[model samples]
Target chain A: MDSAAADRPPLLEVEHVSFRYGPLPVLTDVSLAIREGDFLAIIGPNGSGKTTLLKIILGLLKPESGRILFQGRDIASGGVRPKIGYIPQKATHFDPLFPASVREVVSMAFQASKRGLSRRQGEEAAIRRALEVVGMAEAMDRRIGRLSGGQQQRVFIARAIVDKPRALFLDEPTTGVDAGTQDLFYELLDRLNKREGLTIALITHDIGIVDRHITQVACLNQRLVYHGSHAEFCRSDTLKEMLAGGHHLVSHVH
Target chain B: MGAFLTYSFLQRALGAGLFISLACAVLGVFLILRKDAMIGDGLAHITFAGVALGLFLRMMPLAVALVFSIAASLGIMKLKERAGLYGDTAIAIVSSSGLALGLILATLSRNPGVALLNYLFGEILAIDTVEVVLSVALAAAVVAVIAVNYRKLMFMTFDRESAQVAGVRVRRLDALITVLTSVTIVLGMKVVGILLVSALIVIPAAAGLLRASSFKKAILLACGVATASVAAGLAAAFALDLPASGTIVLVNLILFGVLAARRTPRA
Candidate 1:
């Protein structure tokens, strides 16, 4: 496959976006252009507006000013929202006692897919394939509430990828999972980006783990500080300063 | 047993018990899933106000009560969403206001005699043919909606944000389910009255949770427990010539106690 195909018209573009939550500015003059097949890791300290940026991209939060474009079209203009999938930071907001099988949770992602296939067969196949991708195929029949935190997170990831979305937004997907499980999770995401060419935007606070796995990094603290490659981000003095809680630093590393 | 089956009032009591049990059991599942069991209690009190207002206006109490309860449910939902009021606080506000309003209306009415007690505790034997028809219709409607949108409702209940992200219209579904729950509450009010109707929603579902491994099984078991309680309660009420509402609630309490005991691990 030609690498140039990934460099086509940017898949997502946030132009001069600003958002405030009741007089408190969360994001100001935030702008970013995400290319296809990029594993973009957004890193920042607590309350740094990292998750807010991802929410804007997913159209969950509206910007007070400016526009977000998806495939060169305004995202708010009904431009095929099904192409985007989101894994929320708190998937446990789902009732722990509510009974649902892993397969049922995973297959629900394809509910919006355009495939006109048999509902049962299509859902089953998609669930199986997604679970297999996340190494959770064996636990398909298990109740979601009974699974461990790592296993539950993997199930959610499977749900996100089952639809074959153009872009995947994961908010702290490895928050409570062990280091080994987190490593496996990132490896699966890396494979999806490398082999299947899926675009991923992850919001995480673990800078150390991210430094080793992410291809691109964007550091946020309410505004854009710098935008470039991951190598540049690791070497940047501004990031070091921001990490020390000195000032705002929003850098996009390619 | 033969004498109990022959009386018209006993037959009506039995029918009302069956209807309330089935409807409350189904609605109870959603309540438990949403973690808004208190909302059931709140709505039942609101339905009490509707019942009182219906009697005062000399209208078909059930119809008036249904309309008023559905409206109250919608109001509570809107307040929670728009004002960002916590669900429990919103329920409290609606319930207390409703109870107050009902009390005022009953006080101003001419014949506040048995009607007030009926709304408070329930009057299962008073269920007429119209109430029976309405109960059956509402139960069928609840079943139809649940059957058709089981997956959608389950998805919404599990993770509302993801459901919205998947284009499931979370707000609309939430409101719809609330309306459905209000209908169930109103139907239940006719049997167990407002004070006891909410118990019918919680006890069976809590019992079902102890034993069932899946959502469907839990719901089915809840319905079974509720139905059994209703039947046994109605029979005991007729045999002892006691109040049907007290009898039904006693039966539920007994079931709950037995289930809780069975779940306890031996030292």
Candidate 2:
């Protein structure tokens, strides 16, 4: 609850990162910093390398140059990826009959944690707590394939938070989800951020509503177009043009 | 029935059938979940060529086939990931090339016509005690790996990206599964034959899918169904003088039909 530490060394620092897929550069010298308890929304147009940037930050993809520092330690130096969590874009490739329950899916997040294999009491407790946080505790026993899109999204969010990560990365978590559910989802995320002081980074095409909900914004298009408070991002010309191109933003008001 | 049961060869055949059924049933669950069912068939064909080559060289065919199939599995995985090719396409390409290479080698070594037929359709009736022990050992190794890495494998199968993000080492786990699949295929080919081995891998898992909820339950059900199918099929094949592989496949198909019918809604 020390707001003064916001200006101290950022919890995550990306220094001059660049990445290329063969010849085409998807990210170019992009740099940004995320402090503790920050809800940072990354917004940009299609092909803007928004997802690419997130991958680099998550250490899923390595940069061609520069380094990513997590808690002032270089991520490449065997810095144990702190309990970082992720909710991927809605997977269209999965079969509807893939047999797994919501609780089973969420419990998998603990597989790589210190808990190891076979769900123990501690892992179950964590899964229950995460589901409760996402308002999905009631539907824990439901088949994942049978859930609504928004409900499924919430289940994945619960899975991501089951490990109680210090940082959480979500890729278009609200896409295809209903407006009401999306509102509820963000509200739950806000609660987690405020209550647990969890840092959050989310990528979305919607720029309009993001400003109202997120503490900071990082507008990307193969580069860091802008990175500042929500107000500064809304006032910037780059974000305005990007949002004007028919990209729906997550509105602050329900 | 008494005469067949009294024969040592028949007993060995039954034992082989049981071991194969158990191993394939377990591995088949993951294959079905991962949607790589066809890869099993493709690799089986590739293993056929290995058996043919082994016959030509007068070596233990299963050992050679295991090495060949494992190599093919690795080759298929590498091609898919590194070249960005569709998984089925990669498997198809490798399978055909392996078959062609195997044929050329067998022809050059002048293997007998009976040896070729045995490799293609299997000769479970001729299974030896050594073959049974080898099959059981391979199956045990696969079961242990699955037990130890169950959680990680489940996470990877459901969501590879999330598993990677959580530091589960997705690629390593995938490679291990592929290798294990190769081992299973090689063992399977000994009893089911190269041409029909994949049926064992697909049918049992598909049957389990009809009713099971959790993956663990599905796999357990698959193993039970598969073992039953093998036992019934072997008995029917012995009684009717039919080919063991064909009988086993028919039994699996019948079981699947019964389960599917039971689960279907009345229109």
Candidate 3:
């Protein structure tokens, strides 16, 4: 709201956002901000409107009230609608009958991202590099349906970041994922966060693996129930309440 | 066989068949993948009303059918949005109404039975030079739109909600596909009759998906299978004194049976 706040803008800002489906109120005055290079985890129950908020921030859903600012510019009418990489909550349900190659799926980033995939290097080079990042270079030409669920998920992640997006949003990425592969996924996300400085906003009902990785946590239940730093979150009474509600970090199963 | 080829009627029939096959096969793969195959069926029913209206008014049937089918397709989309109806529900409502209206109109017209039978069963041999030209032009337009927007359309097909979030202009692409499919149905009605036109749009693509290892292969296989089936079906129609539309659909069913029996690539 002031000039001083404009100097160092957060990567994304959800300012007093609210939404509803028909007459039913889904989200009410929810707000949060993600600074550059921050890995923020949004934890909520099934009906707590986590995915709805993510959709609004991703510009897929229009909020009934309030504004979303990406890099301090209004997302609704902003000139620069930042290139955001998204892994949908239901990414796993992709019909197996659809015969698309792993390479072909990732190549979507070429058309999707406004960041302009590759001007200097050839398109194949970009595809290869992205595959390599996800440890899927060997499976580039393989039919997507032939890969395991975890492997397909990695391919989707590769697709998301192939164009070098500024922010990555993962909506309940761990559901149905095996524990071992889930650890690997978190490690990959951690590497992307710490090494590449890629900002991430992960939405999940489960918050076990991400607890150690996230810098901030926003727990939602149809409203802004908790919004604070991870350290403060660990010590606050809200964390106890969350734990009482069975929202505690689920330990990785060996 | 040679006599059939030399006849101008047969030549026009074959030309229209091939062009419609190309359009249907290409568009069908996307429609089937998007779970919109029933759209073909729905549009075909809508075209029936268009045809009856045209016959009653003494106007060009195909042109009227094209306009009506396109309008009906858009209407289904609008109803789905405004009424919170599911896609299949919207299609069912519009298509059943269109079919009923066509039946009522046909009953009200002079020589109603003969007019209805001609359009329902199709008379490809009676398709004039002008009809052939119109069929080719409409088919070409559908193919061109798909070719230009292949990638974007593919994105929408597999995951429309995600595509919308990713800024793929989902509604525009939805409208484009609906229009293309309606036009394809109009052209295909001449090839296989209104009753079996959807068979042309769904079966070839269904067979293609049974064996394709990738998106490109599915498309190529569908188009190849469709055009070849049309050729062979036309030949059989002449040899057996059967309707080309029925023969073509029979050929497609056989192809689908063979392909479905094959193993699919799995994880």
Model 1, residue A62: distance off in Å is 1.0
Candidate 2's TM-score reads 0.92
Q: Clashes in candidate 3: how many? A: 0
Q: What clash pairs does model 3 have?
A: none
TM-scores for all predictions: 0.89, 0.92, 0.92
Q: Which segments of model 2 are wrong by more than 4 Å?
A: A1-5, A91-93, A114-117, A234-254, B1-7, B264-267
| Alpha-carbon deviation at B133 in model 1, angstroms | 1.3
lDDT of 3 by residue, B63-128 (tens): 888899999999998998999986699999999999999988777767567766877877777888
Docking class of 3: acceptable
By DockQ, the better pick of 1 and 2 is 2
- Tell me the interface RMSD of model 3, in angstroms: 3.7
Candidate 3 TM-score for chain A: 0.90
**Candidate 2: clashing pairs of residues:** A206-A248, A206-A249, A207-A249, A209-A250, A209-A251
Instruction: Tell me the TM-score that candidate 1 gets on chain A alone.
Output: 0.88
Pick the DockQ winner.
2
Ranking by DockQ: 2, 3, 1
The better-scoring model by lDDT among 2 and 3 is 3
